[model samples]
Target: MRIAYRVETVRAAEQELIARLPDGALMQRAAAGLAAATAGMLGRVYGARVVVLAGSGDNGGDALYAGARLARRGAGVSAVLLAPDRAHPDGLAAFLRAGGRVADDPYDVLAAADLVLDGITGIGGHGGLRPDAVPVARAARGSNALVVAVDLPSGIEADSGEVLGEALHADATVTFGAYKPGLLVDPAHAYTGAVRLVDIGLEPHLPSVPDCEALQHADVAQLLPVPTGESDKYRRGVVGIVAGSARYPGAAVLAVAGALHGGAGAVRYVGPAADDVIARFPETLVSAGPPAKAGRVQAWVVGPGLGDAPGVEEVLAADVPVLVDADGLRGLDPAVVRDRAAPTLLTPHAGEAAALLGVSRAEVESARLRSVRELADRYGATVLLKGSTTLVADPGGRAPVRVNPTGTSWLATAGSGDVLSGLAGSLLAAGLTARDAGSVAAYLHGLSARHAANGAPLTASSVASSLTNAWRDVYA
Candidate 1:
């Protein structure tokens, strides 16, 4: 798992590490890593044109020190001092000693630079770039140089991942000590093109639980359900899907498509579109009656393309893990969902999430982390907020929220969410926790879409068909 901590946690950990080390030792360690990463990016340090955007804080110091190291290695280094007077005394002195001079014109140096190091702001910064630094940031981006950010890209909220205003877009970012929450999430994640972590002996001082985490392939493989010699269809787990309607029978087919590939022994579908589902997957057990009358199921996926069907209440009343999605989310009674005995996972896109939170769609999209957390807390259920950056938040809010790393724009297709609901519900039946099930589902769903698309326009059914390939690739 790739873990990320909040700014406060990172700062506390940094402080603890700083206390034990020599005064300049910690900064030097960070600077050394930064310089090494910069050198690697440049391919050769000698005769390279490097520009450092230096501000008033330790971020600037790291950049300045790294620039000095490059200067000593025969690189033509120039520092654009945003706060010339308040720059790190030792860092500036070293840079000057190494033949690195302050830029008389920032834009001129930036336009011809081979690489640009952004250090105008750090995790402590708020809102956006300072007025005086805006033009320089723009110039650096407008240049042909490969922009690299130190610790974090300037003008992004370190904790919330909000891009309040103009933010530097880095080709790559080298973060020190621990990964910040912003580096892992979006819209801030979009600014940080690629992220590399530099260990500065802060892990031992950091807390065990991070604020956010992204699961890697091996992690997902371990969580996936596997069959044994003693396992039967029922023992393997049965997922009951309550979805589709007379008007939208395709939803049932798509949901069943995903559920069948989710390691479930059997998929029992209960809805008005039973004929459509059965036609597509003859293996599916179909029931047109209420969900209570459906055969025994370990978990239930309710509400995909369900237009005012009576099964919502019936499924909710079932004593099984329930997943609510799509049209089923409309007019949902918070108290009923909150008071349920079984585990509940609510999968909502931005629009649906907005309805649940009584906020606008724009509000939910702009602040995805906050929106997901609030929905989880308010509904007292695990929430999978779907969008560019899918997030799974638990009701307790103590655990680190799971952020999905694998996703493509092709996943925005219609009926994609329906497939996800079924897939996640199956995982729940397979005995993964709500958090694990939701996150794993998202990971597979996104990966499947990418595979199916392969640079072409993808349909929801294609994504669903690609789930088997996705599952195999994870273990491979």
Candidate 2:
């Protein structure tokens, strides 16, 4: 599994590695790797015009020393020090001795550079580019040449994946140690185009527990539940869905739409909208009572379009893995959730999240990672906060939080979330842990949305129809 430690953990590992190595060995390793990556981007280091936007920390030192390597290779390299007095003395000397020029007028060389290296900030940075680094970053953005970030894109919160201020948009970023969460999440991820890890022997010291993780193709494939030849229909898994009402009977259909195709052996739907659900999906076994009264099921999905129904209490009290969404979020009590005997996953949008936190929607959106974690802790369940970038956090905090990378903003349409609830619920029924089910379902749901629309406007049914292709992709 790919792991991403927090900044503090990464620093501890770095310090341990640095102390064991000979003098300046760690810096040399980082710089050499950076220089090599830059050369690859430029096609040829010799005679290439390269500019380094150096900061005050080791990040700047990495850039400056890398520039020295380029100078030794006959590249016309220059350093524009943001903090001239605080620049690394050894790096500056090495660059100057290797024929690299130091210019305090930042924009002079950056405007005409063939490539720009952003070393303005590192993982330690909490806010945007310092006032002076702005112009040089802007110049790099406007320039036609390639822009490469030394460690991570400047002006992004390395730990939280939040964009603090105006960030430099990099064509590619060469990161040391391991992948930071910001590089995988959105907003900040948008600024970080492509990320390449430069192995500097830091993995052995990194903590096994990652702060967050992004699923790769192989990882997703492994997590997906596969049916075996020996397994019978009942042995696979059965899902019971408690959703929809007369006013929103379509939600019941959509939820069943996802559940029937989502690898579930059988689906038992219980709600007032049984007629509509049966009309759309006659295969579903519709019950007239609540979920607990419904027949056997490996897992349950509660709340999509439930609309303050009186029977929700019975559904919420079931003794199986349960997924809560939409109307299920209304006036929820932590005590009721905390008392549950099984794992529960709560899926909420910003508005529902804001309601849970008793804060404004903007506050929840502003700090989505924090909000998701707080909600998980407060409700004592797995929380999936849906937005431009969906986040999944487990209440136990054992697994690293998952940030979905494949999603389209067009998925904001009605009934999309209902389908997500069904997909995730079915996965939970199929015997994956709540965390795995939620994240994997979200991955598939987002991919289906992308496939259904392919840049065109799409309805919720169209998204559900495309799930077959997405499932095939995971298996492939």
Give RMSD to native, each candidate. 0.9, 2.0
Candidate 1 worst ten-residue window by lDDT: 309-318
Q: Count clashing pairs, candidate 1.
A: 0
Which candidate has the highest lDDT of all? 1
Q: What TM-score does each of the candidates earn?
A: 0.99, 0.94
Model 1: per-residue Cα lDDT at residue 374: 96
Q: Each prediction's Cα lDDT score?
A: 0.92, 0.87
Q: TM-score of the candidate numbered 2? A: 0.94
